[model samples]
Target: MTESWWRDAVIYQIYPRSFADANGDGIGDLPGVRTRLPYLRDLGVDAVWLSPFYLSPQADAGYDVADYRTVDPIFGTVEDARGLVADAHDLGLRVIVDLVPNHSSDQHAWFRQALAEGPGSPLRERYHFRDGRGAEGELPPNDWPSIFGGPAWTRVPDGQWYLHLFAPEQPDFNWDHPAVADEFRTILRFWLDLGVDGFRVDVAHGLVKEAGLPSLGRATEWHLLDVGESPCFDRDGVHDIYRSWRAVLDEYPGERIAVAEAWAPTLDRVADYVRPDELHQAFNFSYLATGWDVESQRTMIDASLDAMGRVGAPATWTLSNHDVVRHTTRLLQRNEGDVAGRKPVEVDPVAGLRRARAASLLLLALPGSAYLYQGEELGLPEVIDLPPEVRQDPAFHRATGQDGYRDGCRVPLPWSGATAPYGFGPDGGPSWLPQPASWAHLSVEAQEGVPGSTLSMYREALALRHKTLTEADSLCWVDTAEGILTFTRGAGFTCTVNMTDRPIEIPHPGVLLIGSGPFDATGDSVTLPPDTTAWWSN
Candidate 1:
């Protein structure tokens, strides 16, 4: 089997709206990302996975792409995107752009034409346009609910209903339509020719649905995250779509790859998306959703590695993303990283930051690729106190939105300076979402040279990862005390994590290379503090 760069690559995901803003527009743009390429290079990431910046109305941020080929004016022009990709390459950094294939913005040219040409138009065939089911055709065709909330079907003035698995502004594409498939192939080639390394396919498991638009028929509220055998998600036919995409990726040189943002019921199903003839990697959401304990993390990690290994694919690990509450905050919750259940409890920010640092080391030491969400290196917590008026997440507006609010994690990153905007924009304009005043101390500039700072820790760990752990593919568990986990990679590298509230003694003979927090070592024995982790060279 041919080796792939994505197998062990460290990919950093940048949420464009919050990354950095140029032209002082209060929104991050491709130009902004261009100017910041050196920063990412310095951080030691092999590639950057950019969230959507394509032409869109911003209904679901940029996920609702209106034109796959065009860049939205708010985020800059097509020239700017090309320039950004070129700039990233100059820094020896690969670029992975997001591809929202499952749906497109309602304002897209094809969708607009479908709406204007009425019910029987051939253009309407490209989308899931169907007649309503009631006597007067007043009801939605099925019981499927929008991921953002409410019914998944939207009615047109012509008495027909169109399916929107997400928001109404985003209409699902009919992959059964040859034209839809052909259009995406053209879109893929256009970006590939422009030199993008790969795509992080949005909703990779959702292009196809059951033949009959059947209802789930459950009384409880619907959640998009609920995986397993569902008529609308992870259908058996999505694999064929990926096979065609893999062929497109193979046409490009330098081993261009595609990563799936697929959410299936199990790691086994997730692995299917990355089979030999499919994508290069699929996000291991099952691992991300695991709790922050020794046993829970260990179980999920084992299951992920085993499942992906069976298919000859490397496992991927990530802690935070644009959609979920930041791990820094999630860890502090009483639920220990379960964002789904709404339980109110006091949060200990200090402990959360400590645990987050430890978690990062544990993830980086694993035998596969790792994804870092922007600002995580600085230990930024989710901005949970955004004013109601400033909230813009579509889910927040809907009564049935699975996650009550996601804007907390999408707040603009703190770059430098004090006060709001935090140097996010060159003109010091207001940000799209407000930044917490406390983040002034967490700005990249503040942590750039500070020893023991979160950013400094990430830089050191990632640098060491390249030199020592990149090719260390084998992992063996080392027996240790309860609440403490120890593992060895290859011959000379060891990682020990202390997950309990009490310190644990490490009996290994080695020099500590990195520690998440301060610890004590006397002679041959070292004590790891609570919620701390350490990497050592034996």
Candidate 2:
């Protein structure tokens, strides 16, 4: 209930590689971001969180850090980062950077040194290492799977194996080691010292593992990430890690926040990541994972609220991220609370963008800060046409012929469709990732201020929220009949959404505050155009 700067903040997440390439090297850089600072400010967000620009081998798209203190040559130098922070601050927008402490690239000097030497190496304690003492190391230690679809352990070729919760390239750090903890704390201090606002931590929940590294229970399905039957690390020690990080954060004087990317099914564990001193927010992916149903949204919200009540941590809701399909695609999957077990109903092609816009409104309406991935406001959809030659995402590379990888969501941001460079750079120059044909129409420059365009609608939506952030208490959901979601926002304000194409009666409401299509309100009911929605505020 206490007022915090991030409480009502609208955060924009920018993946630098795909954001914009100022140099036309086919990769987006800090200067490109610097060029786009005004664009972000125009979006009316409280802060901009840059995904990772640290020195890396690009093994996992910069999540695999080789050096924590400097920026990768592709993204520019530490000076560029400083300039970005300065530019963002000058524009009244807070600057946030991603912190990937859970793992480091296998090519990192520390890992290389650890591989070359034994426990006495300077980087020895930075990672998890174990010796296979008996039977020629047949059944070495425990069963664990790498998040990227292999055993969590890989042979050092030194007759030993180390743990990697994610990709083999991303070796998990050993939080049990005090030296490692100090190193990450130092990394945090280094960035904060740069006048940066805060961090968006990668996998904060899995920071600390079970000390014993016990066996996971019996399982039928064997996912490479599910190291179950080997050990369940999402236990008590996580809190210790958070508490330690919190100590480091406390040492800093100014307003700083941390958001964790935890994807636990239950909210209790999610809440742990956001404990007061631990993290400021955790992604409420329940909505992202939720099917479109009145009951689904209601139940997820209630559970999230209850969990927040227990831990006193504010909850975050997200419809889409760089990791999954966009919300518009998900909306196509949601039905009007009617029958299922039939063919997947095709979303009205005409209303697809509107659904995406409506989803944006839904996320902003929630209690916690809204995290918008780059280009979501432009009604960006997943990219599918990139040939394997142009694909750089590990998710796709690992999936080998898998249809649903994250690269689609991680495509190059479209600045202008008509421009040959797609607003990233010159046509002849390289783009880190390829832009699809549809991007031509769904670009920022093309749609800005255009009536019925996703860009303008998003601007209006954010402006509306900025006008009413302090009066959020008036925001409350009312009735859900006939697949319609009607809610009241602050005081007597009410909004009703009829998610179907066929006209349907809406619950009682005053006048329509805003609408996406034709709607008529009667005494106690309203008729909504097919595949349309409306908002009301009295």
By TM-score, the best candidate is: 1
Predict model 1's lDDT versus the native: 0.87
Candidate whose lDDT is highest: 1
CA lDDT scores, all candidates in order: 0.87, 0.72
Q: Clashes in model 1: which pairs? A: none
Measured with C-alpha atoms, the lDDT of residue 337 in candidate 2 is: 30
Tens-digit per-residue lDDT, 367-428, candidate 1? 99999999999999877777779888887788654665788888989999978788899988
* Per-model root-mean-square deviation over C-alphas: 1.8, 3.8
* Stretches of candidate 2 exceeding 4 Å from the true structure: 1-3, 119-122, 138-140, 217-232, 333-351, 399-404, 417-420, 426-428, 471-475, 516-525
Candidate 1: where is the Cα deviation over 4 Å? Answer: 1-3, 336-346
